[model samples]
Target: MALSGEDAGETIDIVEPAVRMGSYLAEVQPVEDAAGLIFLLWAIQQPTIARPNAFVRQSSMELRLDACGHQITIVQTPSSMSNPGVTGAVMWDSGIVLTKFLESAVDSGRLVLQGSKVVELGSGCGLVGCAAALLGARVVLTDLPDRLKLLKKNVEVNVKERNARGSAEVCELNWGDDLDAELTEPPPDFVVGSDVVYSEAAVVDLLSTLRQLSASCTTIFLAGELRNDAVLEYFLEAAMEDFLIGHVDQSQWHPDYRSQRVAILVLVKK
Candidate 1:
């Protein structure tokens, strides 16, 4: 992608486990060091799932990056290596966890796409929020403490001044945690989520948090990747009580990965 004011390979690579990895050199605009930018090269190469099974035990390769302008020289993991999660960076630093469903929801224009005052929940690497901000939406990239740190840096690093003058913000947001106090300011006009619901317990907290944020007449849009039939069932059961579910289906972003179809649900005043 061409980052404005930056040429190709402007990214700064953070270290991953693999050696003999690829590298690149490019020009990058200065950015705030404390900004929550996820390190350029951290992917949850471990099955891309939470649980680790026999396959999980196998070694996994990690990606290395060198940013130049907005272009990055990324080295895909070789087939031989495994286990890139040694740094705990993968969980929150991975890119495009569920781009297919996310893009679908955003492109649909079904919700109140004010393109202003938006907050994202469980914004792992903040890709979705970044995309929203790119669409002229002022967005907040939020997750846990550690994750927020990197995410904030990413916003400063990746976003150009031309994009709403870098209107994106990053903060700590934990589901099942405070939804009110967590919002640094007044209620946002819109709230978005992606791949936040998969577990039984997470679904409860996710819905509870979504419900809490649902008030204020703020329209909310969520795109999730259900791992299995059970998780899908739980999503329906929990969401049915609070949200008006809409469009659901399976889709893919790239030919390599296909995120399961999702049901779009909008929070209505109860």
Candidate 2:
């Protein structure tokens, strides 16, 4: 629940509201495998759902994450009951981890962000995409059309007017649907997503989109909270058939913020 960076001045603490408890149940104790991990996360979440809260139509918050000497500021919409299913409006811990990972990878020269064409799927609140743009990648942040309003606003505030080599743009992208024409012709060099794998149905859709967009040269990164073992297992099983997938080492990320409840995966065409 704490995102600490390299410097003493760089640490940023985020306090999750009672209404947003569903998204903040991370950092649990490690379990044996994916199944046990998922069950433990599920068990932790059951009681929090029984609470109640007032409706918040709209509000904004600023979040700062420091990693690899880079301080990234994100403008986001905090969780609200008015728009129940619009998960993209809020900032989740998995997104924070992935954003920091991108910065760390770029700083370590393990990944290239400068002048790369990058695409972010399920870019809720656009934090990860904004981080990518700040690292000099031309980033396209995509989500369902209904989610684009808030997603676009976040991108506009955080990523606009930057002198970074790459700029951020918002686009409509429904997983499992036909690939958008603009996205296919150039094929992004890198694809990324955070906290996107949650349901069995969405796993199928997400894999289909990845297949359509990826080639032998493309690299994909996905970060997800280990909140559902069955859903996570389904995605890994299906993705392994077409793309080589492996868990990213926790040592590669900032030590202060890494959590066993979250995972980052690297994927490439087989």
Candidate 3:
């Protein structure tokens, strides 16, 4: 099947086969000169290929923070891919982008991290949270229960060993669940997330947790990959009821770290 759309003399076509034996391919093509359009071509499956043993091994990912003059090492377990339900074991592009954005914002004086209380939701691999802590923000890195082991290890290796200016503690924070006093005793000055808005079913629960974590003076920054338009739309629509949402333009992003497939949004409690 083929789907197409047009805007301002630019057109895009998404073509995919209606049926396939072991795998499928989806190709997105731009018919006109859409300068900023991003084309994605991906395979849905590769049943014939053997599973690699590397997928079950743990790998170290190093992210250098020029601003902090240090490198944070994150351990990524690709084995999580075997379990379709697991997403936090790997480092995603959105997480890297958000971490760099935070660095840039703090360096530019657009954001202040010194002694600020920050909370990170769905902090996969704890990259963003560790970055925040190194920038002098006392940060809480939270995720589902099963994700805490790896998250804690990352934080310990990067933040604790380096004796960063601030601190980070890993915690279990299932969305829509009762809020822990440690998370809300004083209400976080900022709540941040990356690649957390990927499903329509989780939107409501995510919003509920956001609402509970935020105070009237709180600010939220969320960075996400633009993979599912419907899921993002649903989240934004529901969030508007209690937040004043604003998109962070690409021009405002870090110069060396940006992508057309990723978006950053700022939200203030309304």
Question: Please, what is the TM-score per model?
Answer: 0.56, 0.75, 0.78
lDDT of 2 by residue, 80-177 (tens): 43675767776777787788777776766677788988899999778889888888888899998878887777777666854555689999998999
Q: After superposition, how far is residue 209 of candidate 2 from its true place, in Å?
A: 0.4
Q: How many pairs of residues collide in each model?
A: 25, 0, 0
lDDT of each: 0.46, 0.68, 0.73
Among all windows of 10 consecutive residues in model 2, the one with the lowest summed lDDT is 17-26
Best candidate (score: lDDT):
3
- Model 3 residue 203 distance off true place after TM-score fit, in angstroms: 0.4
The better-scoring model by lDDT among 1 and 2 is 2
Best by TM-score: 3
Total residue pair clashes for candidate 3: 0
Please provide, for model 1 over 1-270, each residue's C-alpha lDDT reduced to its tens digit, 9 standing for 90 to 100: 212222265644322221110010111222122111112101211223543221112223332222211221122223312444222233221234333333344445432333557788887555556656655667877887756665665566555433332267887777877665546356666777765655676788777777776655565655543235466555655676655443221232322333223233334334
Ranking by TM-score: 3, 2, 1
Q: lDDT tens string, model 3, 211-234?
A: 999897577888887766667767
